[model samples]
Structure formats: C-alpha cells, structure tokens
Target: DAGVTQSPTHLIKTRGQQVTLRCSPKSGHDTVSWYQQALGQGPQFIFQYYEEEERQRGNFPDRFSGHQFPNYSSELNVNALLLGDSALYLCASSDLGTGGWAYGYTFGSGTRLTVV
Candidate 1:
C-alpha cells in the first residue's frame, strides 16, 4: 500500500476505463479507509483496511476498496460500471492504532472517475 496517490487531478472520462483504484494506510496509521463522492454529494464511506485486512465496510459493493491519507491509493473494483459510478473517488487514512481513527482523518486529493 503506497497510501492514496490519485493521478490526473482533472476528470477521467470513461468509455470503459479501468475502474480500479489503489490505496494504503499512512506511515503511523494502521487503518486505510475509502470514500466515494458523487457529482454533488458528500463523500460516502465504502470500506476500510486495517492491519493489512479489511475490518469495516459501508453500503458498497466489493469493488470499493482502499485507503486515504496524505498519500494513499487502494483498489475499487466496479464489475458492472454504471453511469452512477461516475464520481470523485477519494482515499483517507486514520490512526486506528492510537484509538484516534475515526476522529482524525487526513485526505488526499481526489480522482474524478466519469463513466460514460
């Protein structure tokens, strides 16, 4: 895991683009979390990987997996890429080891994935 490192700060139009992202926990953080932000909505929690294993998950399919931190990138797989999947995917990291995981989260930029 190299943390959440998003590329193409702009938008990535998709006509069948590889809908897979990457992420990892921060250096001191042991929990890697992922989020999905639609065009006009707040980021939604997808899942979290802690201790190299998935610990918690949200109302998302198996495709949404990864972490977000100052620098991170996880993998979110959307088998059936839908137009609704087109949104900003973000990665975040938290210090779950110190019991301050949900409170303090560091988020990196976002990768705008457009499904067309």
Candidate 2:
C-alpha cells in the first residue's frame, strides 16, 4: 500500500557537477515517469519507462538520462548540472494501459536539487 518513494529529499550540487536521483514505484505499478518542476512552474515531463525501457521522452537535453529496473524502480541522472537545473524532481508510477480518471499515477514527494 505504499506510494512512490524518492530518495535524498534534498540535494545541493555545484554547477558543472552531476547528480542522480532514485525512485521506487508504488505497489502493483509497472511504469515509472520523471518530471521536473521549477518554482512557480508546473511539472515538466522528463521521460517515462516501461518494461525496463524508455518509452517516451520530453524536450530535455541529452544530459538527462534514466533507467528502470526489473522491480519497477527507476533512477534519474543529470550531467553537467547548471543553475537552471535546480528544481523539484518528481517520480510517478502507474500501470500502463490503465488510463482513466480512476487509475491515475501516484507521485512521490520529490527530490529538491539546488545547483549553486
């Protein structure tokens, strides 16, 4: 009955450094997705994973990468971090092919990354 979980609730990194965020999906979930939300802005899709493969991606740079594990856990990695990269990184999990209002994704509290 646990929801999605993200590690390292907060992080600080210097510009040009790299960072990795971790996530564990909700029970019975198979798909995992990542999003970035800046202050005063809504969440922006980063990418999605299904069957341990990336199924979809948004307009993020190549520096952004992700991986999904067999157990439905996932990881998000950012390289050459910039000040603009500072934001709340969210991980959402849901069952694929179960699209509808009643089967919405469950999101984690998110990892706050600050690039100084």
Candidate 3:
C-alpha cells in the first residue's frame, strides 16, 4: 500500500513558463486533491478530482488545472506561472466515501516549484 507519490521533488522555472506536477494515489484511494503551500503559509487547496472528473475547485485561477486518470493518478498543470507560484505543490489522496475523517488523507512529499 504505497502512499501518494509526486514527481520532480524540486523544479525551477522562469516567469511565464509552464509546469506540470504528477501524483499517484495510495492504494484503495479514489480521490486526488492538489494544494499549494508558500513559505510560512499553510497549504491552499487548488482542486480535487474524482471519477476522472473535476469534483471541486478552490480559489486558484484558471491557470491552475488538474486531471485524474482512470487509475486514480492525477496531474496538476500550471500555466503562465508567476513568481508567486513558487511554492511546494502537494498531492493528497483519500477515499471519497471516507469523508477524510476516519483515516485521513495521505500526502505526498510535494514538488518544490521555484519560479524566477
């Protein structure tokens, strides 16, 4: 039973560039959510995906998008990145029916994106 996994643990991109972060959900998990955490700030929800559809979204702009695969894996895509986008992008997985209360969510180590 592997936990959520994210790729490119660290990344650096110029302003206006685009980046894609990937995640694989933990076994038995069916929902995937993305979050952004800036320095000294708590994680901000980006969006969540389930059944290969966008189930819910946060206050992020349209530039922040995501997709969920049939296998329950997911990807977060950021376009026209800004310096403010520099942060730790975390992926969390949970079962839809669990309401994320009993077992809680499993989070990835996150991808550190630095926009210069």
Provide TM-scores for the models.
0.75, 0.95, 0.95
The residue-by-residue lDDT of candidate 3 on 1-116, one tens digit each, is: 78889998999999999999999999999999899999999999999999999988999999999988999999999999999999999999999877752578889999999999
Give lDDT for model 3.
0.93
Count steric clashes of candidate 2.
0
Stretches of candidate 1 above 4 Å error? 1-4, 8-18, 63-73
lDDT of 2 by residue, 17-98 (tens): 9999999999988999999999999999999999999999999999999999999999999999999999999999998857
Candidate 1 positional error at 76, Å: 2.3
Cα lDDT, model 3, residue 106: 89
lDDT of 1 by residue, 29-81 (tens): 65667788997799998878765567788998754544333333355566557
Top-down lDDT ranking? 2, 3, 1
